[model samples]
Target chain A: MTRARALLIVPLAVFVGIVVLLYSGFGLGRADLHPSALIDKPFPDFELPTLAGEPPRRSRDDLVGEVRLVNVWATWCPTCAAEHDELARITGETGIGIVGVNYKDDPNAARAWLAERGDPYLFHIIDARGDLGVDLGVYGAPETFIVDAAGVIRFKQVGAVTADTWRDSMAPVVASLQAAAP
Target chain B: MTGRTVLGITALCIAATLASAASLVDAYDFDNPALEARYRTLIAELRCPKCLNVNIAGSDAPIASDLRRAVRRMLEEGRSDQEILAHLQDRYGDFILYNPPLSPATVLLWATPAILVLVGLLVLRRLGSRRDAVELTEDERARLDALGAEDP
Candidate 1:
């Protein structure tokens, strides 16, 4: 091909390449959504009220010494409800610690919701003001973060942690994190 | 009748806007005008992590609300603008910053438009040059005329 013809193909090729790249970019974005800004960092310090009575508070300090999932959920969120059984199963099968953040939810409503459908969390923390949610960079309800033994946030699952998500992403990360825990 | 209904709806919308505007008033008091200016700029520049490409100031998402409060608290505590921006950016990733810093990750983002312009100019220049096609050889012209004569 002549130099001019070859040069003409370059822009066309770049345009096509960009189109393909954008298509994949959108696909990946939809899959991950808002990846929580707190991955690979220490879990944000928060002293939130517990969902259950008596203890009244749960903090990041309560999550150290083992790999655990810090799940953000609310009574208002249907996705959290959808993922509840999966979370229960993870807790039941793996016996791993899952700390639930009852994000911006009514205390009474949150208590009732968990009571109605078995509370899977080791300890459910109340984020009634959503202060912890913002500090944790929580996009929305049903986000799960895997914090290692030292309180460092290792991985973040942006959406509902379904059986598929647990099997595919969180399980593998959990395995490594568990191994890495001191 | 339709016009009256439209006017009523417009009035209702204006009322709702005013009510929400009143609700959005910040609770924090700035130490100085410079601090207030910095706070405003920071909120405007920071993306609401929970909203669809909206700044924290405009977004009503719970995260946005809390972020606004956090910014105010930081400003009140005498944290520098850079410190507050870095703190939020570190937690929310570079996506939090509306005007992202020029860095390795954003080199393509900053360069794509410029590259496209250069490519466009190259194409235009090539096209302009091509318009002045090379002169056909006398022998070639004679052959073309002969072929035309036979075809006719």
Candidate 2:
């Protein structure tokens, strides 16, 4: 190629690269949809009190042997409340188990919120101090994780799981995981 | 006002300011200076997972405070710096650290500056070679000599 043509190629390649990069970055629908590092890894070990404040506290051992959605939520987060009904509907329709993590919330307030809003989870782990939330890399409430039968995390959905979210993003993953389960 | 009274008021203000500043720093008591220094350094290096761009030491978020406490606790437990960082990384991934570890995913991020420099040097060399490749025609050389001679 001529020197001018060679020089032109460099800038053209750079422009094309930058355009592709920018377009891909913008194509990502949500800014909060960060990729979780714990995907495909076993759930973090924790033996925390149940939200019911009963005996037989739950731990990582309880997560195995089932395909479930481990949802991180709190009474203080309004988005969690907003998604509560949708979550219950999802469980009702899909027959998929949901385990709740009551992160960094007052136990009384959390219990009241669940009772008022209607509890969707099979059981709730009280992460009152957020220690278990930290262990699970939960930065905010309304985050959901799909854990396979082996207790391996398959996918993480940040923010509230509305009906649309379940239909589009989460339901497919859950279906696939359930199909794959023994 | 009398000079003594004025000095006493100024001293009081200074003392008050110092006390307030001290209160701003987290009061985690360390058994030794080395442990305290390590705690400070670790918090400074660790990014606040909840915030946009602030390190744990600089952020006031609840998560940042919790991370700060965790770092101090680990340091007291006799964990090495790498161990502490790895502990956070295992949960939060490499995003928790301001300086990410070199891996297949981050190779491009770490290599971009050097790649830019290499490209710049190559361009510079090409330009230099092009300048050298240019040979003035005999007539042009004579004209250039004549212009130089006229300057004298």
Candidate 3:
């Protein structure tokens, strides 16, 4: 082949390869790599402190023996701010203990954010370094996980913990866990 | 020209070609400081389709440039970072973000790698057993030894 034709074919071949790779799932996009459906599996183990001014961490032990909604949030995350009101309302209405995992956030900022908005968390666990969040496979906040009385993870919501989500999706899962005898 | 001069001229032509082929660098211009900072942050969080791990802000790929332009346009229109990101997600699907939206479509993608690994393991096991079973026949082994001896 002539040099010009060879050069043209080279790029064309590369473009075709990329298209094939995309079709075959190599470039399937990061959104395709989300494991949000393993809702009913056991909750991953975690340990973190509550905000400094607030009470000490309530531990994974405290999480057992009751259906709880664990929310991973950070003061820095914009979505967390958006969902704060919904969380407060859910706590007030459902009476299902809403636990908070303040993933990789400043303790002072977290306390202030909660103070400014209203702390809906029954007890906030400070995942200051994001170690606990990693265990939960939390890519970002505000993510909510529902753990049963037996500590089995029954549900997970990847984004903002809104009232609609709590009522429509989370509440039913929590209720089922409540009705079942340990 | 003599052979050496011809070779030197060819080298100069190659150098000139390389210089002309080099891509131009773009300088960042921020009209609004707050908007620019937010734009930078948003772009940094977005994954480039062509360069996968390198974010739009960091990548020089054409697709990244297009995404950066889109981000700037959205910011200039007074859209918040969330709104801009949502718009991008809508246009490109959740793949635009480094952290993808956890939806039904994504659940399958997340599970597929593990499933592929499992399937591969199963295939390997079957192939391994077949390989073990299809050991060289005595005649084939003798022929292989004869071929090796001839090569030596």
Candidates arranged by TM-score, highest first: 1, 2, 3
Q: For residues B87-139, could you state the per-residue lDDT of candidate 3 as single tens digits?
A: 66643446668877667767886888999899889979987997889779899
Which scores better on DockQ, 1 or 3?
1
Q: Which stretch of 10 consecutive residues in model 3 chain A shows the poorest summed lDDT? A: A29-38
Tens-digit per-residue lDDT, A7-91, candidate 3 = 6787689799988977888555443344433455667666566775455655778788888888888888999899888888887
lDDT of 2 by residue, B54-94 (tens): 89887768888778877887888899999999888877878
lDDT by residue for model 1 over B1-152, one digit each (tens)? Answer: 69999999999999999889657646567769998888888889999876759998777777788899989888999999999998888777888889888988789999999998998899899888987886889999999899999984
Every candidate's DockQ is 0.39, 0.43, 0.03
- Leading candidate by DockQ: 2
lDDT of 1 at A2: 100
lDDT of 2 by residue, A57-77 (tens): 988888779899999998889
Across all candidates, the chain A TM-score values are 0.83, 0.82, 0.77
Ranking by lDDT: 2, 1, 3
Interface RMSD of 2: 1.9
Candidate 3, residue B10: Cα displacement in angstroms equals 19
* Candidate 1 displacement at residue A169 in angstroms: 1.3
In order of DockQ, best first, we have 2, 1, 3
Per-prediction TM-score, please?
0.77, 0.76, 0.48
Clashing pairs in 3: none
Q: Candidate 3 at B147: error in angstroms? A: 45
Q: How many residue pairs clash in each candidate?
A: 0, 0, 0
RMSD of each: 7.6, 6.2, 17.8
